[model samples]
Target: MNKRFALLLLVLLPLMACNKQETPAPAATPAAAENAAPAANEPVPADEPAASGETPAPAASAQTPAPEAAPADADAAAAAPPAASGALTPGTDYVEIPNGQPYLPLNGKVEVVEVFGYVCPACAQFQPLVNSWEKKLPANVRFTYVPAAFGGPWITYAKAYYASETLGLVERTHNDLFKAIHIDQTLKGERGQDSVADVAAFYGKYGVDPKQFASTMESFAVNAKLSKAKQWAIRSGLEGTPTIIVNGKYRVLGKTFPDMLRIADALIAQESARPAP
Candidate 1:
């Protein structure tokens, strides 16, 4: 394996040994695009929310009822002792996050969609690690990427994603997408900081049409998919990037990733045995 690949594996393997609680994050809005300069060097989001969607709020943000009328599951978990039981049952514990303004879920698939941007350095580091994890995914699982368009240069990278997926160049050229932007710094917001055609054309060398790709990047179809992805991320109670959601309800966040796959597996197994809705 190349040194970078090895380093990435080493970094991700330890994640299995730890798990992060899926704490709720602030509501996603275009105001917080990945590359947007924060006020006075403040922190920023690793992935930006898509333009045309609104994700569901997390459980922590759920409507609170009177203490006397507490929800059954909440009371049960709180009253039960930890040594004898676990917290929250699948399905009963959480609800589905709707896809924003657009796409709906594909039937009979366990989605593992990732929300990422080519220009984010943290996203660059996450690429190889998630790719390795994908290779070992179960037959019932499905994986997809939500290319975000929060900033001007970001939309260009988003176009590259659509073109690559359309032309079957994703697996071969995916990693390079990030490297070309972050490592080599070749992308300088082409077309006067508003157009992504130059980079989309670069993917065209691998057989993608820059114009058609641009249209799809802004298409209703892509918009719906982006919306759903945001919903999935939000319902998963994501605190940051690199979160994974199983089905529309069960989510893995924080130090979750591959390691949290174990808990995800447990939840999936249990859900599989339950009666269908």
Candidate 2:
């Protein structure tokens, strides 16, 4: 029975996250191709080509569809489990980030940041779970979304995310954007060469002017946030999307989506228990 359980975990692990890789430019090098190899811990191959028009080596594909769930039912699916207890095994469940710090300045609250990209299908799959999970969080915990800028369509959506955020449209459009790309097919995923205008037109349905949305996507402020997000991903040593960082000190590495939240709950408890600085 134990062996069967372990084997089941192996099969499910690859489905829970998207591997991060650089989309090769036209003048790509052999060394660049070598760098695109899947990490030792990641077994899935890259099936979706990046929007750069050059196919990257096999890693996890970003085009996989998330399981279907009605929008209204997502919260019930994400209801928080009872508080986790006992010491969770390090390295196995999660790894500590050396010199890690919150994505934003500490504000007398525990910070939980999810590093995700709109173009990552794995992230889209994890969205419903996290959306509900976050809603039940205590007032003392702050949840922040840091978009991943992995180049190609990733940069496009990252820019769109920041622009929407600047215009205060993210709270209304976040999930719909995911549905548009992954389910509705109204928007394209990382595989498509989506431009700023394409993304802005989608936002137009929500009352924002398309031209205004497009301009905001390229604004200096949005560019700064995009740059900061890239740096945060680099400093976190992020190798995939849908990663959870608790208080910026631990990176959750659970084998399944629910398991990831379970681990994150435990870490949040641990951080909450620490004496105030």
The per-model lDDT (C-alpha) reads: 0.49, 0.72
**Candidate 1 has what TM-score?**
0.55
User: What are the runs in model 2 whose C-alpha is more than 4 Å off?
Assistant: 1-17, 20-84
The numbered model that scores best in lDDT is 2
Candidate 1 per-residue lDDT, tens place, 158-232, comes to: 666765676678887887666655556555432134355667666666666767766766777666655544344
- Expressed as tens digits, the lDDT of each residue in 71-129 for candidate 2 is 46767657845434655767756778898878998678999998887877657656777
Q: Identify the candidate with maximal TM-score.
A: 2
**Model 1 score (lDDT):** 0.49
In order of listing, the candidates' clash counts read 5, 3
TM of each candidate vs. truth: 0.55, 0.72
How well does candidate 2 score on lDDT at residue 17? Answer: 34
Q: What's model 2's overall lDDT? A: 0.72
